[model samples]
Target: MLVAYAWLTLVGFVVQLVPNAGPGALPRTLAWTVLGLGLVQCLLCTGVLHRAIDSYLGTRTVTDARLALPAVLMASMTALTVVLVAIRAVEVGLEVGLGLHGALAPFAVTFGVAVPRRTAALALSGYLAATTAALAAAGLPGADLLAALVVVGLGGLLSVFTGRSSAWYIAVIRELEEARGVQARLAVAEERLRFSRDLHDVMGRNLSAIALKSELAAQLVRRGSETEASVGQMTEVQRIAREAQSEVRAVVRGYRDVDLPTELAGARGILRAAGVDCRTDNGGSQLPAPVQAALGWVVREGATNVLRHADATWCTVWVGTDPAGRSALLVMENDGTRGQAPGGSAGSGLAGLRERLDGVGGTLRVARDGESGTFRLTAEVPLAAGNDATADEAVTDPAGTAGTHGSGTDGKDSAE
Candidate 1:
């Protein structure tokens, strides 16, 4: 919308470049100057408008210094536009009457869209009053003054309406984001409580059995009746300990095997909650369980990196078969990779992902495009039967631990 208005303003200036006969050098020069200034004003105003909207949404805090320069430029351009149109109106005598009134519309609209209600309204009122007085001083008739006031008044109202509506829309989005955060925290707390209860259930029976057996063994030893009964009781205690250990391992494995589909949905939800647009495409859904688990970890880590390391506004996660159909590929890409090194040391999360992918006969790649300010993470694992067999063998090997291989660009390869 802002760009559209700017283009319209530019067109208005371009129209002014043509004269009655050949070309009026002064009018053409003024038109070019106004056009250049308007373009600069638009560029600066983009940042100011973004900051203003974010500030209103409670998502950012901007200093006055950031906004001051754009505000001044906007005011200067508006005054110049009005002056130019007023001079043309005096020269052309009522033929350029609409130009005089419409000169302030762009600035008024920008003010309404980017500034707070009271400030925009106050500034617009003052601007209208000044422009009106200037037109009168330039010998505009009383009827022309009334007509200009009506047009300027309507433009100001439109600006105010646009600004207020944008504020309301941003407020609603912020509220939804806050609600999502609360929901996520609640889910974490609930999961913690559930895990604690499971732990207690798993341990309570074994601990009770151990205590009873030890008491019986102590009694037998004190009475000196027999060592066999005491030995048997000790064996039962060791059995209970082993059972408890197995249960704990199962619980941990359950926690670690986060499903790929679930993680993808969660990543989308979480990124959207943080005001980042997230899109995911699952090219196919026939992947093995181990393969799904590995890609799920990639999605989780990529989302975390986007939130913690980048200032991205959009992220895309894609899972598809490689061009050769010999491997499955997972790619996560996001803009705003500021402060991140494209070919620097790998972070712990990426290092761990490398190890996991390697254990499953896969590769991990990370790249940052400095020109576009984007970060991309790519994971590829062969989809052949032998690849699954190799992964299974790797998991079963008692002494074969996952090891990392360097990928040259800020990521590690997880191939054995």
Candidate 2:
């Protein structure tokens, strides 16, 4: 209210400098002029002040009946002021016609109407053009309309450019968020590969070793070998068997050792014992320990699954280190379930194997040779730095004997 009063006073003072820009003969007198006019304006302001505050707070909703009354009252007061200004302008012969502020009024009113975005833009542009033409007609100074046109054109262009820039920024942020999602998925895949490789490393060789020793013991018994020799072989076979069982359990529980060669050998023996023809073609002599571990998990899971599910006479397990010595591969194929086994439950072993392989930048592919009655599992392992015999030696402390090999860690084994 104080600010408004100051502004009104300033405008009145400016008008007074122009001759005769005030009301009756009383305003013409030096004694009664400024003081009387100021008192009248202050008294008139009291009624408008509370209404202005009420408008700001939106006390009356747009559709409320009370809104019409306040709006009417404000309009009447505004008209009266405008009439007084016009009478003074005429009496004083001052050039007090509409200016920049008047030109902006229509656009402000359109915004109050809450027009749609495109409509608002068109309305603003049209209002500016019309106002410019009116000013031109009113004899605004030489070439000033051209200057006004330039200003209007720049304002419109700025609005458009700023809007487009804001939209582009939002799009870029969305793309970055999507990229982060993809990266997360890739990380999950890599973890699964690592787990698969670890499982192969732990169980494969241990099982294979047990199977071979068991077969050897059986052969010695058939040949009528000495009891001590047969007993020794059986003891070793039982030990390996125990280790293989532990490795299997550990893998299923998502933990396993990092021994590559031992796992491969064990896998071969386990598959062989389960009556599947098993083979390990390479030891990955130059592949990194990480790569070896990944391949080992593949072999372990493959062989374990074969033993548990492949109701077949033969299964074959193969391990190959890359010729360039940069990677390792483990492949297991079984001639099992000529037709679907039971209701065609492939078992959790293959699923678990796939997960483990995906963890270490590795991949596992499973397919059935429809005509050959063969199911195949293949894995690929990429080498990493510091992957040598020394690293292997460093990691091979047999610290994970219980957890990785799956010796059950339970007090007793259930009879098979």
Candidate 3:
């Protein structure tokens, strides 16, 4: 509203500068006074009309009084300004001619730059153009016709600019919506993978045990000494069922633990299944429970990245205990040919891996070898001798013995 008043004041100042108004104190005073009053009324009408329009648009119910009040006020204000300007133009002793360009300027500010609707806004422009043509044909000389032509040309330019701005707005909105959609799909995919992992963990062990017990029961039944044996097998089956149910609940609650060796084995299977040769080295025995757990998460994230991002043909995984003190290193390297990364997004997966390891007083590193096109992920975790008892047990067991041994292998692992 204040802006509208400012514009009105500027318009009045311009009108007073028009040539050939006969020198008279009374006429000059009347013209200035009427112009000031018109400006003030224009501001008041603008405020009232603006509030009334907002109310009408904001509500579902509309009353006749709401519509009529603003209409009457705006009409009266516009009429007063027009009458005063017309009288002043006549008083200047020049034929009173309304220039279309000047008359349409306010509407252009509103309908073109402010509201910016296409069909309706352009319709308003057309009305302004037609009215200007009519007024240009009245009273004054060639100047009015020229002014009318200029107004129409400017209106066309305004429509183009406004329409272009609208198009750009729509393009930006569409891009945002697409990004939201992609995020939603990714969320759903993650949930599905979580559910599948849970289901596998819950059912795999128990189902295998159940099958073995049933086979033993069948053998006893065939031998006809089945009474006690069958009972024991049935008891074992029930026990396995209960264990499976407990595991299901635990997995649903996100409490399943991953042993480092188990995760390493899983990574081997996944890489091999993807037609990638899997080479693994763990310098003798299991890692400390805490270090192993952290490394397990690293292996998990690494395998996921390999499957989703790296199109690998050969992969190597290495895990080792720190000799000087308490720390373990886990490394997974894949010979994946990288033409280009999708979306050109630097690895956010690796960033998350780093953050996770950092929480456990560990660190992760991801590097790509350009020549070989191999991507390597490494995780370093702290551990203590007492914490690595499971690894010690695995080393004592001949069946569990695999990979190279000790600090000497650490140098080889580093080369990975």
Give each model a TM-score.
0.60, 0.31, 0.39
- What tens-digit string does per-residue lDDT give for candidate 1 at 9-122? 445633453342124566566655655665676676565666666776667766767656655665565455455555552244232333433344445555565556788778
Rank by TM-score, highest first.
1, 3, 2
lDDT of each: 0.68, 0.52, 0.56
Task: Give the C-alpha lDDT of model 3.
Answer: 0.56
Residue runs of model 3 more than 4 Å from their true location after superposition: 1-122, 152-182, 197-359, 362-416
Report the candidate with higher lDDT, 1 versus 2: 1
lDDT of 3 at 160: 36
Candidate closer to the true structure by TM-score (higher is better), 2 or 3: 3
Predicted structure 3, TM vs. truth: 0.39
lDDT of 3 at 75: 33
Cα lDDT over the full model 1: 0.68
